[model samples]
Target chain A: EAGVAQSPRYKIIEKRQSVAFWCNPISGHATLYWYQQILGQGPKLLIQFQNNGVVDDSQLPKDRFSAERLKGVDSTLKIQPAKLEDSAVYLCASRRTSGSSYNEQFFGPGTRLTVL
Target chain B: GQQVMQIPQYQHVQEGEDFTTYCNSSTTLSNIQWYKQRPGGHPVFLIQLVKSGEVKKQKRLTFQFGEAKKNSSLHITATQTTDVGTYFCAGARGWGKLQFGAGTQVVVTP
Candidate 1:
């Protein structure tokens, strides 16, 4: 079986420009998550989707960051007018369970973004 | 909330030596998980602990969840070069969200 798939291994964009990252979780995984990992720091969860509905996204910066998991299989994260602080690896992960009772997450290779 | 704290921000161990990392949370977690992230790579899940005072092992690695469910530890016996990477502990509560620790960077010297 294939693992999680992410598009565009790496990306470089100028500040204030827009960019998008895509992710496809492992087959049969009902819970999906998006996190941002800055250099020297642990990943911070940005949003989470259970099927096609959002389970959590309180940490997401609505002013500039937005994500959608349409049809419950794949998701996309967009950052418009990207800031220098937005330069980090965007990781996609999925788990077998939809509740907080579990914590086994399978992560993708991640999309590394560099804002110039 | 800065829920998780990992001790020994960085650790350097000689080959065949033992190593350990500690993780503490501000509140009792529903569960705790451990992950290993190599340099320039994303995190990979290693193990998850749910029950209080739980202990699990995988080969030379051992993991323990505190009785209070607010702390955990990962111990590697006779470390090898393959053990090099950053080790993280994540705490989860009533939601699916995960709060990750700063992580312990382990460097195994040959």
Candidate 2:
């Protein structure tokens, strides 16, 4: 089975510029998530989507970051006026909502954003 | 809000030695999952413990959940070069909300 897929494995942008990352989760997966992983730290959940609806986004910085999953299959995360502190890897993950093996998450390669 | 914490931010172990990493959570978890991320790679799921005081093994890796369900541990036996990576523990208070720990970076030397 194919795993989660993401685009632009690496990206570079200037401070104050806008950047967007894309994610295509595994087929038939019902839950999708976006995470920001800073250097030397574990992934921090940015937002979570449950079939086109947001499940949680309390940690997301609404002033600068936004994400959407229109069809519940693919998702896009955008950051406007990117800051140097936003330089980190953005990871996408998916999980099966039901069944015996629902807890395991499949992660994508991630998009490394470097804001100069 | 829930928080998960890991100890020994970094560990350097001999190739044949055994080492253990720990995960602690501020709130009791319904389940705890472990993942491994190689340098420059994405995290891959290793295992998950759901029941309190549960222990599971995958080859040389042993995973244990504390009786209180507030902590977990990953013990690797006879560490190998292949074990070089960061191990992360994510605890979920509810079903689908996962709070991840900072992770323990392990380096094995020959």
The 0-to-1 C-alpha lDDT of every candidate, in the order given, reads 0.93, 0.96
Every candidate's DockQ is 0.86, 0.92
Residues A50-104 of candidate 1: C-alpha lDDT, one tens digit per residue: 9989999989999999999999999999999899999999999998774553458
DockQ-derived CAPRI band for the predicted complex in model 2: high
Least well predicted 10-residue stretch by lDDT in candidate 2 chain B: B92-101
What is the DockQ of the complex in model 1?
0.86
What's model 2's lDDT at B59?
98
> For every candidate, what is the interface RMSD in angstroms?
0.9, 0.6
Tell me the native contact fraction for each prediction. Answer: 0.93, 0.90
Instruction: Point out the worst 10-residue segment of candidate 2 chain A by lDDT.
Output: A97-106
The estimated TM-scores of all candidates read 0.96, 0.99
- Best lDDT goes to which candidate? 2
